[model samples]
Target: MSKPSLHQYYLSLIPNLVSELFFYIPKNEIRDDIIEKLDFLNTTNIFNTIYVVDYYKGPIEFKKGRDNTRLLLKDGDLDKNMFNLLEKKSEVPPHEFNYVLDKYFELAECLFYITNWMNTNINKMLPHDDTSSGIFYMQSLSYKKHFEILVKNFYPTKDIIPKGNFNALELIETYFPDIASQYHKPAHHPTEHTTPTPTNSVGVQEEIQPVLKKTKKPPLITALEAEKILLEQVFNVDFKKLK
Candidate 1:
């Protein structure tokens, strides 16, 4: 027997949960095109040209999804077409993308509190320390671009994601002053802000990726110039293993 997919798990869990906020279904019916795109991520075909090797997940044009060179089906589903798209940019339509991305998040091993408390007053909720990296501590992440304009505009700068580590005190006083005002005041980054922009759009961006740039050997990813490239460019990094 195999473990259940993220979808299956959500279905089983949804029935028991009290909060209806955690839902996978779109308010309006899901578009057939989006359904096809979502379904495509579940199917893994070695001959499909999506994977360079015999398995899924890897490093290729981008660096985040897998440790190797090929892109993960799950991650690739959200990308825009290579011609018009870039990595980490999800294509799922804004209206339905939120429902879909939440489905994708099931794959990420993270704490609910991390997303839940990102804005609210950490000092009010918990003890704070000057040296300690607050709960939201993070310099930046790939998904920041997708955040709705409201969260984006909330910050004075265009690029809202910064401060590698989110400190409770810092977030309340400095970082997300508008929404992190919860408890003490009001909070934000509502569920609606998830619409994919260059990034948010979600997994069904209906993207058509070009064939992966395969490695010399399926089992071992090696290149003559790759050593220098990987060392200088990709080493110690989680994404983009190829040169």
Candidate 2:
């Protein structure tokens, strides 16, 4: 049988794992398949960036481009609407956008690992003292720094706080009680508590029925919260459990 194209393999692995974790597929069965495919792609250098390709135009648009470019254009020239049709035609549900984003980060991690390994091994193959061209040195340094940051920030071990024995969510709850509570609460409904109708009473007008101005809340706990929670949980101390 013909080998699957790199893009096909990547596209296939992501949707399923994303579906499994987010779409409620059985974890036990899909877990192995997900890991295996992710590993295969990693080992084979299949994934780099999540690219939305236009088969008609034969170019791939990296998702990162969305942040800086106008919604209508990416790479300064390509029209984003062309891809809008593909997005519309795509079978993936809109709700699964988060899943796709998570998978993209996962794939980026795998790419970082593979790229780091390649850079290290290739350096070993070259003479130690070889003073290469400026472009080569620049590229090497750039990639090395990229991999270093990726490994440092997203390392699996780093995810475990106290350097190893704690859940990130629990840590956040412990360290940032206020922030965590805010995140859990439903979005503040502005319409539910608009300014009270301007009262014409000369007196205090019954205090104007204090408009229950929705309290502004932080979105999430910081990384430090994760660390604090890890310590508390591991020691079996009541370090502020999340509501």
Please tell me which predicted candidate would have the highest TM-score against the true structure: 2
Q: Give the TM-score of candidate 2.
A: 0.23
Candidate 1 local distance difference test against the native: 0.27
- What lDDT score is found at residue 142 in candidate 2? 32
Residue 160, candidate 1: Cα error in Å is 25
In candidate 1, residue 134 scores what lDDT? 24
Candidate 1 error regions (>4 Å): 1-102, 105-119, 133-243
Q: Point out the worst 10-residue segment of candidate 1 by lDDT.
A: 18-27
Model 1 error, position 107 (Å)? 8.9
Error of 2 at 163 (Å): 16
lDDT of 2 by residue, 1-243 (tens): 997543453465432211101000112222343335443322532232222223233224333223321212221121122132235325556545434433434443332222223333333433343322222233223333332332222222322222222233342343323333544666566234222221121111112222123544443333334323322322233434332
